[model samples]
Target: MRFLLLILLFCFQSIQLSAQTNNYSISFDNAVHHEAVISATFKDISTDTLTLRMSRTSPGRYALHEFAKNVYNFTAFDSKGNSLKITRENPYEWKVSGHDGQVNIKYTLFANRGDGTYSQIDETHAHLNIPATFMYAPTLNERPIDVNFSIREDLGWKVATQLPHVKGNTYSAPNLYYFMDSPTELSNHKVREINIDGQTVKFALHDPGTEDEADTYFEKVKKVVIAEKEVFGALPKFDYGLYTFLACYIPNASGDGMEHRNSTILTSTRTLANGGMEGNIGTVSHEFFHSWNVERIRPKTLEPFNFEEANMSGELWFAEGFTSYYTNLILCRVGLISPEKYVEGLTGTFNYVWNSPARQFFNPIEMSYQAPFVDAATSVDPVNRENTFISYYSYGSVLGLALDLSLREKGLNLDDYMKHVWKTYGKTEKPYTIENLNQSLNQYAGEEFGHNFFNNYIHKSDMPKYNELFSSVGIVLSQDDNAAYFGAAVSITDDLNGKIQSNTKIGSPAYKAGLDKDDVITSINGKPFPNGIQFEAFVKKFKPNDMLSVTYLSDGQEKNTEVILESDPSYAISLQEKNGDKLSKKVLKERKDWLKIE
Candidate 1:
């Protein structure tokens, strides 16, 4: 009898604690000026002072955004309508005292940037990324969150979000983490949904295009969803048995894609009738893959993502890069792109990782650690990233390609390996370490193969035998030995002087000759090049081991130097038939199986 009473008492107390909900209401009457009036009400306060803050970082992002910089017109009130004392505790935080058991706080948010990272409000629509639009009390993080949007019905607006709908214009989140992850979009957009395995997948597209264009785009989105589902064997069990693609392809939106627990934010400035029909689908393939890879098969370093500071992780190579490797491959598998185009498309990323000097300083693991500084981070001073960094996305994608081909050589495949990982870590929602991935590969393949791969390519930054691997599948990895390489892009000014566009590559002939960005090339080989086209044509005249006298103006001073030209260190991937190489029966079968083509 005593034990039953104790259990009942605990259950009753739990309900009471959860009932202390955080209520928020936002009205966009002043949305024409790119502003929103947001208010938060906290009830059942038990402390002498409550600390509230705007998030410095958001999920799926590594850098600090300083979201508090957009907040102004702050005020607070008690239940009796008396003003409460508020003080600035820090750049992102406010401390409120002299409040009764209940307090309401209001502020005006100036949001104009429309991307996955920030909020935007205007006469057209209100695109809200939760971290950039809302503030919360750290002490009340465990309480339920309720948000009401006074939407502009005059503009035929509708609310679309991953948040569970409570009633008209109201949404609810179980806790702060889920609330922060749910971004909402209010606009007059078109929506399409498909039911798969007892779950509904929705595509809410806010684009100014014809209905036919919207239908065509949604069909492509469906193919992407199904293709990615095949990789992981099934769709993730979404939180509410639903998943949404909240895409804003409008002129005012910035290009970005961010993955959340149950939805993804896809924003771009290209509409469906424009180049977005092809340009934006790659982001779709990349972010949907994250539904399984990073959202659930999470890195331990990013688990319980911090909102007060930057979040760093060393697993983004696999988290981001492996997904990148599959991005276009999925498109090919679904017949959206031809197999030849997919194979040829590998050339750009392959050459980028193969020829970068940054690999000498950091392996894939160390490169993953640079996310906080390079991932959407902003800085005023110039950086030497040309010599120090390679995007983990590109690096990891090529690595994933290598591993996939290597595993196929052993009568296994990456699909099975990913399924094993999904069952072990992703489905269970268990955070993983790099060692976990190593062990997963060991179990899927063998200890010897796994150890060799991680030790050489991942830990030590050694180049893979890509030529031999490509040959096994009847693909050619070839480079021109006689192509001239100047290794610096130059733009011709209206005066016909060639101007360097960016930092010169570290070991290129241009860098060796002391050429840098903003340098104007007045004369080359003792001749003044008339235009950029002519300058490029002139450089093609020299072969490797040739020398030329170059003159340029750097920082308003004329300079002269001798540059030794080298052959272009770029590789191309193509089908054996395209290169006129005979494909043996075994190689033909291997290629067919690799590309799933008949």
Candidate 2:
């Protein structure tokens, strides 16, 4: 009965930011401890009892991470600075009673992982993903929030995020959704701002590399931003008056990139001097393109993201996969990667989607729905994921390739389709459905093309006509079915015991060598196979008809097997130019224009 007061108070504060009612302030000590002390004070109270919750799932992540698992030592106080009774309602919610009109809550956050999905804090910096760091009351969800980071000034840490900065270390967000969607990075980082046609885009860098390296990388990023803007015809008018790219290239940081409303978090363990820029730029391109595709042109199913449950959508193929295609396309158009590299990347996607047996069972939409289980989701039991599922990103990119080539053949291309969708659905904050996308395809192209494309490629498990489509642009599509075969998929768990655990396919080289499942591989050709990676790397050097000796342990008994490796049936995709095929003037013209070249 007493908890009801807190719920009521939360409701009252959820309205709007007025008279400091919905205001929130948090402070943390920048120390190199696994645990960080966080004090969150909720101001302008309404009820006596207060309730707060930690998020279970974050935006862009389809999996439920149970972020509450990291929070501990929660306590509450009142306006008179008196202690209050706090109760653990559930795994995610906390209930407090006997509080005054206001509440001052302090808790400990245990964060070690650093990526787009999780939060991490240390002596150097703190990557606070709001969902993993801050707790919000259910009633106060709609209310505005003001965040102030009180850090160690001697450490030289400043804030970089899309949240509207009011003054000093204070920031303002319209609601909890926007607040949580903004990923904040704190470090004594270099700030580089560039103006793209009057729109301010800033880059906050946490790199230990040379200034020249940083400049060269961000210059390419500027080009990517401009090229993507050309695709959308304009940028999303950021409510914060600017957009930001928070990039952390520290060796201790994890490699990840997550998209946000008007910013992105690009973290990698590679320093700038290592030439990690090229690969990381793909992440930058992909996440930035999402600022248009998924941020504004959001799907109705995902607009109001539920932080407590898995968020599913059928639009990711276009949302993520088409963005995957554009990630590479933008890089290629900006001349960051060679045309051959660009083609190789697409061919890799093509080979993955087409060669995987999963395509026979799932289409792009079904694949998108499975994101909750596969996208960063962990599983304890071993299952054959490779045989049953194809990543929507892979299939969607391949679909983008086939469809773009198809459209180009008809004198209509993906750029036109993208522009049409942006104008129709993206510009007005109108959520889109698959039917809407198909309708746009129908309106721009012929109705028959849309029907066949969606029905055969998206809804059904049938490979698109890649050969004919590529032929229109003079890029011949051929396959090499007879290629060097590596045995069954190498299953490697990041653990100490280096063993062959999976049931290798019958008659394969490893199987023929009498290397049974669960056999602890001791050595290969006198080289220690202490880990799966070393073994795989050694095997990659072997070709068809190669002879080898493998040593392993079965039932704790050592054994040696002499085996002859054989070729596995596979296909290779190469461009017509690479294969010395004819490139007509039409093909050259289509390629140049499609790549945004004169």
Candidate 3:
């Protein structure tokens, strides 16, 4: 009987070894006028159906994207050179059947101007954002997998991946587990490499212009990275990389970021020459912290990714919000930003959440599960779209700050909770739940911090005591009044003549003015307002309760109304350093140190 048991154990080990030996080699070589050919070969697979997926969801966006919709010219073949039948099972997944044994799949992926997929124009440049094109099987959830890629040598293209490079033009990864664990961004983006704390970190992006400007911007990023690592103990992997692709010019823009194992892809407006460093640093810090929080210690639903549909989890707040909270905190700790700057960041989040009308409609958890559908349905209407949706990023960050302070008030801090989380969920390789988080916090705070605080404040609509929390840390949250006030959040369409030809409803006083969806605001208060600046200035001149006459063109017809001016409910938060006795010097000192070198 003992001998039989030994044989079973040996068989299990052999199966594990065989699974580990499976590998994938991908080559992106055929670059025609506008399209690129991607070929992938998989070894030692016995499944009758091989499923390839174009991920609809990415790390940063917290939304579903139909990535396979972007792919074209897909085909699959068996090892014997016989054609395999391929069928589209869903928008994001494809199934290839009749695989005699091993198989090779090749497809031509279209590169569009959108941020997620493979994008290219001329030989001068190309961008390969992996989630948009790369497809994998559902069976290999946490299985070990490897990927190798060969690219055009003369294109002057440098590939950046979180996957470790085994040799020249050959990259080796631990498994399909780690492959999806990290997303790769291959582009002609600019590259910078720095060594800190015995780890080499690489930053790659398209060089927009001016060496001095680039250096100044990246130097601040370097400092933030160093500081974040110091706080987190050490980066989880031996080597790390950051890839930023400037797909287009970004001027005061907003976008999403996708986190991979060792790398992340950020889509944002082009960093301006002035203060670009600060902006880039903030972005880098947010994405980098995901290395610990979400990528490793993920919600159970996120594990064994369900590419066909949404993997819903109410804990997205912890995944994204905690990362957002730490990003600014790390910046403050590293001295890249002052304590005032850190507070200002938190205040921005606070005001954003407070001003959002959706907070009244949906709790943070409900919004987490429903955001994908809501965002997709309302993609066209900017105000109605996101205003109705809650961001774990915004609210979660605030909650993180509050939770940190609450723990501190009890003679503990986020560090203890984080350690508890890492041990209870991250170390055990388990999923996150409210119960688990509460239990962990109970252990750390020596009381039921999770149930007592999270249920009352986070899971419910109860407004958090931001003033009290910030006061505990020697920061005061202030409301800004002098900022421009538009009674309604409006989206304007410019005519060929560059005139504001149309204004769309974005849930404001304008929406309540019996204004139809596409009303062309010809004039406000008897003044011709043809542009945003004019509209903003016109709105600011009137105080709340003032009577104003308005004229608009609807469906090519003239319209008029007598409307009452009202205050814009949109709130913005500012931070001030407090030197009062509300917080003890010892508490302030501890909080400051806690943020720094965490």
Candidate 4:
């Protein structure tokens, strides 16, 4: 019986090893042209022709980048270096014919944009978001990937990636899912290694910053890592064996950060060398939290990410929003942010979510779906994003904050619930639904409380009981009735104009008076408006329905109109310190445990 068990295990291992055979090689010989040359070879051709596809979108990003649009001069050749006949099936597909049992496909990718979504190459370095840089044969998407970075003799470029290294400049991935998820950088970057509770963390900065500030910057990031480790109870068993932080803090580089299985791409236009360590903390902390949330605690709708089409999901509220909520919380707990500053940040979130009219139109789950259009996706036409779409990031974070307080009152905490969910879905790479999340919350807390909380706050447009929940944490969610009022947002474009930047909200006095986004506010009540604040202050002196004569520009023509002033929106939260007696011992304890150091 023991011999049979061993034999079975050996067979399974053999099958796994034989399945990983995808090979890829990329060279930066054409980097000066803002292009990189990629060649992929696959043996054991099962057909006379192979269909290759360039991804239209990337994982972790919801927009369709149309990566194929950046590919030029694509060609395929046989093992003997014979040119193969190719057909353009569509914008995203290339049909290659006349390949021998082995095929080598090559293409030049023009990448000038720098962000989390696209590939950018130059004489200095090559920054690749995998899907934007590589094309895969359709049937081989499930196969393992082996990559070799062909070195330039004089460039002194070194590879920084989370893909497991098989040899020098050669890395291996378990499958295309993992391959496409790994972003790579090739440059003569500086390397710093730090030991964080036994984990070897590599920080690869593309441009060498001041050694002193770099150390301080990384130490702040180290604290965030430790705080999040306590939330999940343990760091994930990274497939690459260690973690990498690919930092690009150089002038002209766009600011962005993207998460992956075992590494993150941190790019910034500003460098930490010149006292920019403070700015680096918030963003790095957010992406690091994604090391657990979106990357591992998989969302069912987004699990098998569609590179060919737009990928939309309803769990971004938790995936991104909850991570955002914890971003600052973790920073504060680590002493990077003062307690007062942290509370001020929290107060800002409450004010935005509570006062913004967008919340009335879209709930968190509803806003999550808007990611397909709003999250890094571009459109050729104008959009009314300001008054319609509320970001799930802000909405979900506020909900997360409220839910945390509510759970704590019931003798449970959100950290406990998250740990439970991590054990069930995240660690296994098993994608989950909103229902799965609700059930988990119910299991941790009472079903009635969990169901009501989710339905009222997440599923519906109704907000949570913030005033009640905040008291338990020794915080006050206060509103001032006497706060001044205005119904429109005005922006100064130049000396000649202060434009009404947003189409007046429905029922707003400006909306009733027919003011729109491009209308230039030339003057107020027949006098020069001068600035937005002075105009707003002049209007604030009146009550709702009070009238004023306004002058503006429409489509390059001058006009005059009368706009009534309306009362400010009803809900706003201002965080104020509580009196000594109001903050009970129980409230103090709750606040301590909620933001306590790990």
Q: Kindly list the per-residue Cα lDDT of model 4 for residues 1-598, writing each as its tens digit.
A: 9999999999998776564387889888778888788888877677998889998888788878788988988888998999999998699999988887777888888997666777778877788899999998768877778999886658878999989989989998888888888898888887777776677778887866667767777778778888898999988777746889888777756888888888998888777764457876788899888988988898999967887889889999999999989999998888998766787678667766766778778788889999989877878998877678778888889888988988898899999899999999989878899999999998889799889988898888787777888777766665545544556777777675678877667667787788888888888777787664655666667776667788888998888889866666655333335343456677777878988933
Compute each candidate's TM-score over C-alphas. Answer: 0.97, 0.87, 0.78, 0.92
lDDT of 4: 0.81
| lDDT by residue for model 2 (1-598), tens | 7799998888776553464545555555535785677776777677777889999888888888999999888888887889999887689998887876778888888887778999878867888888988888878787778888776578888999999988988898888899999999888888888976677999999888778888888898899999999988998887756899989888888999898888999999877777677668888999999999898888877978999899999988999889888988899899998777787666667766776767766788989999999988988987666556788888788888888988988888898899899998889989999999999999999899999999988888788777787766666676533344546554544554457756665556776777766877666678766463554555656677877777767898999887677765444555678877778898889888788766
Say which candidate scores most in TM-score.
1
Model 1: how far is 278 from its true place, Å?
A: 2.0
- By TM-score, highest first, what's the ranking? 1, 4, 2, 3
lDDT, candidates in the order shown: 0.92, 0.81, 0.63, 0.81
Off by over 4 Å in 4: 1-20, 195-199, 531-545, 570-575, 578-582
Candidates ranked, most accurate by lDDT first: 1, 4, 2, 3
Q: Which scores better on lDDT, 1 or 2? A: 1
| lDDT for 291 (candidate 1) | 94
Q: Name the lDDT value of residue 250 in candidate 4.
A: 71
Better by lDDT, candidate 4 or 2: 4
Candidate 2 residues lying further than 4 Å off, grouped into runs, are 1-16, 44-48, 484-487, 490-569
Per-residue C-alpha lDDT of model 3 across residues 1-598, encoded as one tens digit per residue? 9999999999999887755454555555555454566667665666888777777765444456676765788888988889999887567777888987666887776654434323443354445555555677666544555566556567666666667767775666555555644555444566677876566667666545566765666677777776666545555554443332232224422354556656666655555454455565676788777766876677876766655555677777788888888887877877887766666656556766766667777777776776566433236643543456667777788878888887777777786577668766765567787767777777777565667776776678567776776666666555445443444444445551112323323455655565654566666667665464545665676677666676877678888876665665544343333433355677557666666533
Question: Candidate 2: minimum summed lDDT over ten consecutive residues — where?
Answer: 480-489
Q: Tell me the alpha-carbon RMSD of every candidate.
A: 2.0, 6.2, 5.5, 3.3
Task: Say what the RMSD of model 2 is.
Answer: 6.2
